[model samples]
Target: MITRPRIAAAFAAATLIALTGCGANTGSSTNAAADDFPKKGKSIELIVAFGSGGAVDTASRLVAPILEEELGTNVEVVNKPGAGGQIGYTALASAKPDGYTIGATGSPSVVVSPLDPARGATYTRDSFQPLGRHVVDPAVIAVQPDSPYQTLKELIEAAKANPKSMTASTTGLQTGEHFALAQIQEATGAEFAPVHFAEGDAAAAAAFLGKHVNVLVGDVSGVTDLIKQGKARVLGVMSSERAPSLPDIPTFKESGYEVEASTARGFSAPAGLPDAVAEKLEAAIKTAIEDPTVVKKMEELGLQTSYLSGADYEQYWAGQEAAYKKVMPLVQKKD
Candidate 1:
């Protein structure tokens, strides 16, 4: 019914329309996906399992502005504290795969809850898809600069000689720092009066500085502040080797005890996030972590910026799971 000239003109007009309208086409799933992703103008929820003001919360807030710039929407952090982070991880697992809901979580603990049934978890490693891992904060055993114990050896010997005579503070019960404490007991046969604080590392630092506790097990990121202020002195690191940031500080291994531990922080979205959308989020996170400003901020926060994307992040978590499985027994509260 139509001549060749008319058909050619119609084809040219359609081509022009498609180019002008962002390549949208009826029944074109690719075009639909590209447009629908992030659903522009919609906000993304960032979940922090612990209460406000902790390392995870601070890291999430820093990344939020960067994500907002990249994703073109507000990134809101929701604090849902319960059961030592099980509540938040459960919410992340149960969230729809639409890529709107995301969470910042720590390794060893993230891996801990799912494997340790005592945590009463509803999620597994497969629950949420990891976007990327950004930070690895090694743990440290610190004391007040003017404490009687000059070295880790002196402190352990004293604690070993008299159980509960010396006190130790941890961020929480069965947390990574707590686990490190357990390892100290296992390795050195020391008995310390373990104190729990919901305020996490900052509280750990404060307790030791205020002399509320004789010793504090805290993340390198958290303890660095105290060290810089000349309030606390690190006795030993829990990691296998001295942290590059603290070259002079020796690890438990280097100090003659075997304890390798650190906290890894990263983001993840609900399971089954469409690959396209997940990739977008991953790229944004990677870019943010690599930014000079972000890098400087992380250094100031005492966090080491280590970006591990997708499979690399998963592999790291799995490795932590294996290591923690072996170390979990050390942390049991002896009920």
Candidate 2:
């Protein structure tokens, strides 16, 4: 007989079974969605871990439209600049592992931020899945057009004679410019008081142009306009070879200083992103980076196109991490 108690128990059992089935279906649906990434209408967010109008943001914006066309979805470039890219890196790492949220990752800020416990960065090298690399912007040292230092050698000698007398602009503490400064100090015993602009290259360049700083330690992409307009004079490029964009400027190597540093920009998704979704995103990025229009645009901005696929991109990051770690002590801010 189906008594009241028996009926209640039967109902409970049915409810449990239904809930279990719903759970299984939920997981299956999630897997299916990941397998069929983009889903036709959902837009992808491309986080730029720097200020707008800066090199990273500029690159992200340049590629967003191409990525949108290639992936058949909107690619939104969101700037989350602050704390020398710590805020954006944390945001990118904390995002859901779904491929919808990817970020423009650059070194050595992205690599060295987590390495230093002081930065308290929540994300490490493993927090991201590199999709593809875009460019390698070589660093440059520039002074006012009327500055006394005409050659890199003259600037180094003056800085060596009066350590920390000259003020140089860097994007922020422990950024690419700071690292370049450290490399110069370590190699040549020249020290310039670093003025940090956490807002990114634009701010740093502005400070230099406004005469707030004596020298500008920035990337080729950041100062390309100034260099072309003759508003600033480049002392040297911190690259093995003379940057094609600044072919007239001499490299640090040419000046007998062994310092080569450049910032590599790329796209990366949150770690644990689904394999199918990651593959799709990687392929889309590869296509966008290789587009002729994109290539020309990057070159016009003084950014050299250096494309690397997902696996190779990750390896590049790994190598950068190792290389930066060795020099971390040299560039870390002293308490």
Candidate 3:
């Protein structure tokens, strides 16, 4: 028999008891107990770590309506931007476990925050109860339309030719995009100065468009408009596969670089929530993810669907955190 991770086993046990309604002894008696698992008449608040119009915000907005319909309750999406998503995640961790407040969190928050010293965040994968994973946003390397470098090779050559002159724009130091760029630099032995922007993706895009930066690294959602309008051209995507929205772009691995990173969006309620409440929230998220409207919205935003319920989501996060830990030390700290 294949051995599973300790957390996976734990999650499987919990899920079997909660979701499948399977007990050691099953009969009409178990059905009565299983009927109590579905929670009714509850309101859930979903906190989006980034500002409005971001990938996370857009995803939450698209899924919240469908979730509202599925749960037969009110679901609200609130924007809480700060510390590259730690502020909101910290807040979510501290909320009451009544299952009323959930947060839509992705990379940097789930994987990178724990590795950063400045954030001062203490919670781990055990802090919150995972509802489910929703989408995966792949990182992309893009440059201003008028830039001399048209391809990843050309950009690498330019950076290799002049180490610090060619600067790349990213949200902040040690962020997901920053890490992706660092991976590129390490893989190719090319050096480019990093430009930090305050407003995340929008600021990074603006810097590139204004000729303040030669390159910008971020998720496809943030730069989709720029790519569509010829303001920016994606050099490569940092994913195992090419994004459907940008079919012409090649993956970093495919382009002879071994860098692959993807940010995942998921829902989580505060820890210690009742199993019934968690089940209800999970079911709602499942419904939202399967909804046709959500599907279309995700496709338009260049997001990949990935659903993981409760224990599975938590275990997946643990693996992500471990990977980030290995990659964090390789990132060059910015002053």
Candidate 4:
């Protein structure tokens, strides 16, 4: 479970479900919303919470053309790109619930934002309708091509030996990578200096590749280009199992550190969308994301397609909301 929405505080999550029980079931309501959607020429807006060129933005751009072909309309990718994904998510939360203003963002914005009040996110789990999950990109520990650390164990031991001397770059403060790094610190008793900047797909990887940062704590997809260019090497992927994109890369667990964290990127619209419209949007998303060509492109970008549509996507996300809270205490909020 990598990304999700409409599931918030424990008690509030329960009450939110009670209030919006229309989304609890399957099929019957979907048919109603599917009828008369788009009318053939509607222009739909797709917002990407992170900056252009990042994984989130890349996913949206890749799907936009195919989505247009499927829906018979224009699908524009709008990048808000700030506040560690809060800005675009808020835009989606505040957008009209007419099925034309859906947005995509990573999981931490959905799962961990509520725990950090400093991020000032306006949308909670109840604020939007989930369209579908697009990608399950696990984080990886990547070091410079010529770095001393050749294995996950070596990196952990080195960090433990030199405390703050080793630095790990992330996309932003308190972001998913930051939390993942914290989990690594807690699990291995190895302290690392967390260095973050926006647009991790570029900046974080650049920092690590240029030797400005010692390590990159970013998604596998985010560092694909770097790895492909031989600018970096992955020490381990942060997933329960090895990622298909990089089958040879060991998981943190395999390296004797029980850590698994990933960003699940997906689409969502403002709450209260008609069942027919939601269903229609979800169908278009699934078709676009799972297309063979699209799947090939994702693989090239080092991403794996993991589509969960409508109610099924919502159900899975609701569970992750609870899972994220357990790691919240370890994260240090940034103002």
Going through the candidates in the order shown, the clash numbers are: 0, 0, 0, 8
Per-residue accuracy of model 2 over 162-234 as CA lDDT, tens digit each: 9999999988878999999999999999999999898799888888889999999999999899978988999
Q: Higher TM-score: candidate 2 or 3?
A: 2
Top candidate (lDDT): 2
Better of 1 and 3 by TM-score: 1
Instruction: Give the number of colliding residue pairs in candidate 3.
Output: 0
Question: Could you tell me the C-alpha RMSD of candidate 4 in Å?
Answer: 11.7
Model 1 lDDT per residue over 1-335, tens place: 99999999999999998886764554367646845778867899998887787788888888889988888888899987655566778888899887789999787667787776666778899887999998988888887888888888888888889988878887666777778778788878997888877555656666777788888888888877678888889998887767766778988887688877778899998888776788889998888778888888888877779999977998888888888888777776576
Candidate 2, which segments miss by more than 4 Å at Cα?
1-31
Global fold similarity of model 3 (TM-score)? 0.83
Worst 10 residues of 4 by lDDT: 1-10
lDDT of 3 at 66: 87
- Each candidate's root-mean-square deviation in Å? 7.1, 4.6, 10.3, 11.7
Candidate 4 lDDT at 296 equals 97
Weakest ten-residue segment in model 1 by summed lDDT: 23-32
Give the residue spans of candidate 3 off by over 4 A: 1-42, 332-335
Give each model a TM-score.
Answer: 0.85, 0.91, 0.83, 0.86
lDDT of 4 at 173: 63
Among residues 3 or more apart in sequence or in different chains, the pairs in candidate 1 whose N, CA or C atoms overlap within 3 Å are none
Better of 1 and 4 by lDDT: 4
